[model samples]
Target: MGKMAAAVGSAATLAAEPGEDAFRKLFRFYRQSRPGTADLGGVIDFSAAHTARGAGPGAPKVVRSQLSVCSVSESDALRAGLQPVSTWRAYGLEGYPGFIFIPNPFLPGYQWHWVKQCLKFYPQKPNVCNLDKHMAREENQDVWEQSKALLRCKEVTKRRPRSLLEKLRWVTLGYHYNWDSKKYSADHYTPFPSDLAFLSEQVAAACGFQGFQAEAGILNYYRLDSTLGIHVDRSELDLSKPLLSFSFGQSAIFLLGGLRRDEAPTAMFMHSGDIMVMSGSSRLLNHAVPRVLPSAQEGNLPLCLGTPLPAALPRDTVVEPCSVEDQQLCASYLKTARVNMTVRQVVATDQDFPVEAAEESERDITKEGICHLEDKITHGKRVRLDPDS
Candidate 1:
C-alpha cells in the first residue's frame, strides 16, 4: 500500500484494537504523511501524532483529553500566545523561558490603598538621610573612605551561625515591606532562627528544593538619569538553587539573556509586586537593567506620591499605587526608586560539617589514651586495665 494509504489503514486498526502495536502503526502513518521533511522529522511527526491521540473507550475521550492538554498548554507552555514552542528566539531571549501574569495577585486596590495609608503615616518626608545622596556628597568622601577602611579591617568569615534561619525570615519580610524603618539584616542558614526556620519549613513543603539560605536585603535606588550597569547576579550563589526575587516600585525594564554576559538580552517589563523565580540551569544566566525609561508612566493610574504620574514612565500602568487625585502633587519628585528583595539559600560553611566534629572527637580519644600511658610510666607502677575500658 502507498504510505498515506497505509497510515489511514493503520489508524483505523488502532481505533479498533488500541494497543501498543496499533498505536505505533498509526504513528508511522502520520510520519509518512509529512512531505519533503527529514527522516527524523518524519519520526517526530509520527510520535506527535501518537501522543496527540484522542481518548478511546478505556482512555479519556478525545474531547476531554484535548481540553486538559489545551489547559496545561495555555497556562504553562505558551508565552502570550504569540510564540511557537522551542523558538525562544521569537521571545527575544533566544532561550527557553516562560512568563506568568498574575493579575492583581496583591489583592485588588491593595497597592493603591497601601500608598495612601503610607502617606498618612509619613505625611512629610522623614528627615532621615538618603543613602544614595549621602554617598554622593562631596564632604562625605572622608566618611566613605573611613567606612571602606573599617570594612577592610573586618574579617570576612563564612561561619554558620545558629540563628541563620531567623535571619532569612527577617530579610524576606523586610523586602516585602520595602525595608521600612526597622533595621533588619540578611542571615545565612546555620543556626536556624525564627525567620529561617519558617522559610525552611515552607520551602521543604513546596518540594523539589535542593537547599536554601537567606541574605540580608540590599536596597537600591535610581534617580531620573540613573542607570544600572548590565550584569548578572551569579557571584557567591550556588548554581543549583534558583533565585526568587520580588520587586516593589516604579516599573523598570528587566533584561534577561543567555549564559554569556555579552549575549543580547531579552527585556521584561517588571512592575511592583511582581515575583520572578529563575532556576533550572538558567540560574547563572546573564541579565540586567540597562536603563529606566522615564517616558513610561501610567497617567490615569494612581501614584505612590500625592502627585500625578508624569507621561514619561515607560511601561503601561498595569498597577496604580495610589488614587489619581492624590498623586498629582509630588509624583515627579518620587524618583521612581524600586525595592527588590532576592531570596536564596547558601551552602553551610565548612566548619559546620558534621565530619569535622567527628574527626576532632577521634583525636581527643587518642590524646587521652596516650596521656594515661605516660602517667603509668612516670609513676613506675603497674596499672590494672579494666576490660570495660
Candidate 2:
C-alpha cells in the first residue's frame, strides 16, 4: 500500500463519533507541531506527478486538460510571462470534474515579478490590509518603503523586532472584503490593479472561461505556523463565476473539502508559481491552508525562487525585472513567508448590490446598539514572537 493510503487508513481507525467533524480531525492531525506527530505522506505533490505516477498521495489520477490555445495569442502570452498555450500542462483529478491545477506554468524568472508586486506594491495606500484596524492612515501607507531597510538587514540584526511588512496578515484589493460581516458592499470598493486583472483574464480565457472579470481579491500572508481556518468562499454575489488562486514563495498544504464541513478533505501541495482554478460545481468548495512547509525553518530558500531573469524582455511585456533594492527586500521577507492571491468576480455585469438592503442592515445593527469588534484585541498589550517566527 502507498504511504498516503496507509496514513489515511490509520486516520479512519480513530472511529470518529457520529456528529464529529472528520475534516477538522484531519486538519488538526496535519497541524500538530510535535515531532513525528504529523504525517506528510498523504499530501499530494503535483510537481512529482510525472515520476511518482502511481505512488504519490491518493495516487490521484492526473489527467491533462484541453486548453483553448487559440483563445490567447502568442505575443499576448509572452507579455504575460506565460509559455505558449500548446506547451502548458494543465491537469484535472479523476473525481474533481471541474477542478484544474496548472503546476508552475510560468516562464523562467517570471514569478519574481509577481512576488515583488505582492510584497512591495499591493500593500500600499488605497488597498485595505489587516494592519489598518488600529494604525493611522499616514502610518499604514508605504509599508514597503518603511519596512525595506529593516527587512533587508534582517539577517544581520537577527534579534531586531518585526517590521510592518512582517506584521501584514491579509490585504484586500478591488472590492474589499468585510471580515466581520463576511460580505462585500458597493460602498466599500476600490479600483483593482490593472496588471493583475489582465493576468487573471488571460489565464481564464486559456482555461475556457472567456470574459471572466477580475473583481475582488484576498491576499493572505502566512508564516510557518500560521493557519487559515476552514471556510467556504460563497460571499460573492455571483456563484457562476470561477475563482483563480495564485501561490508564491515557499510551499503549503491545501485542504479541499466537500460541500459539508464534516466531510474528509483531500490534501495537496501548492508550491511557488502554481495556479489553481475552482470553477463550476467546485467554485464554492470549503478549503483552507492547514500548514506552510518550513522551507526556511532551517534557513534555506527553495531553489525555484533563485531563478535569474534574462537580461532583457519585450517592450510590451506586462512584467519586467525589479530594482536590486526591492529584490533584496522581497528575498528577505520570503525567507520565512508565503503569499497567496485569490482573484474572483464578485458580481455579474448586470448585477448591482442592493444598496437599500445593505443600508437597512446597517441601520438595524445600529438600532440594536451592538458595536463591531476587531479580530485582534490586544488591549494596548502587544503580542510578540521570535524574530524567525
Per lDDT, the best of the predicted structures is 2
Clashing pairs in 2: none
Q: Rate the local accuracy (lDDT) of all candidates.
A: 0.32, 0.73
- What lDDT is obtained when candidate 1 is compared to the true structure? 0.32
Worst 10 residues of 2 by lDDT: 365-374
Model 2 per-residue lDDT at 244: 95
All candidates: CA RMSD (Å)? 23.8, 5.1
Residues 1-389, model 2: lDDT tens digits: 46545666655543254566877777777666232333666666777746235223344566777888899988888888888878887877766677888888888888888988888889988887777765877997999888876886756343676788888877788876665566664565688988889889889999998989999888887766567767777888888888999999878888877888777777788899899999988877777776777674554567777875655988998886877777767877888888899999988878877674255334211112111111221244332211100
List the candidate 1 regions with Cα displacement exceeding 4 Å: 1-94, 97-104, 109-211, 294-335, 348-389
Per residue, candidate 1 scores C-alpha lDDT tens digits across 157-239 of: 24522111111111122211111212122221123223322332232222234334543222233332233443344433244
- Which predicted model would earn the best TM-score? 2
TM-score on alpha carbons, each prediction: 0.37, 0.87
